[model samples]
Target: MPFYIRARTYFKYAEEQMSLAEKEKDPEKILKFTLEAAERAVRALWAIVQVEAPKEKPPLEKILAEIDKACEPDLAEEIKNHVRRIKELAQNPSVEAAKEALILSRQVVRRTREVLEPIIGPAKRVDQHRRFYF
Candidate 1:
């Protein structure tokens, strides 16, 4: 799958899982779903990083640095901080941690979109000007 598509899919899954977690009464199930959500969100961010910085599977830090150069410093820092928080929370896996991760992941996605909009630009629609006559 394309990076954007995969990232979007993962993010959607994360959102769904988060909703499920919220509705569930059991603590264990809530944790499980929350962790799943966090994992999906992290995966989505990874996809975004891969798309933004194509460097033969570079380390996350390197990718973040590349992103920093490509985008605004504050946005880059926010993304970095979110990635760090998500990683940390992924290790522990708690409801609060998951919520934090989800929020950060959403921010990362939004910021990534903002950064990529100019780089990717609007989609071009080609028009066929010539008519073939037989």
Candidate 2:
């Protein structure tokens, strides 16, 4: 998919996952949704550079590859770092980890918007509420 459609698709999924995560009472379920949100946000970033995310372990590498694929300058390293946390959250699910994942996922989506919107058209404003943790 191209930037306009790809970014919008994944970004919307990310927001929805975050919403579910916030409402979850079980720590594992919270982590599950938070990880999905983060993964979808990273997918949106990949869309920005017109790169497909690698389907495998090491989500950080999956996200970071987009930086080189398009040779896009000014790719934020922090997004990759956040991906690391997201991957770790998968291994060790907890309320705190889910909260961190939620925050990091939002950052990835926000940063992706900064780049994606200008190239593909405007990104719709998604809700920016912080997910309340258990």
Best by TM-score: 2
Q: Candidate 2: worst 10 consecutive residues by lDDT?
A: 123-132
* Inter-residue clash pairs, candidate 1: none
Q: Which stretches of candidate 1 lie over 4 Å from their true place?
A: 1-55, 119-134
Worst 10 residues of 1 by lDDT: 120-129
Cα lDDT of candidate 2 equals 0.69
- What tens digits encode model 1's per-residue C-alpha lDDT throughout 58-84? 455655556555456786677677767
Model 2 Cα displacement at 47 (Å)? Answer: 1.8
> What is candidate 2's lDDT per residue for 1-134, written digit by digit as tens?
44657767877898788889778888788878877877777776666566454345345465576555532454556666777777787788777877777777677666766666655455544333443567
**Model 1 root mean square deviation, Cα atoms:** 9.1
Indicate the residue-level lDDT of 130 in model 2. Answer: 44
Model 1 Cα shift for residue 37 (angstroms): 10
* Superposition error at 45 for model 1 (Å): 10
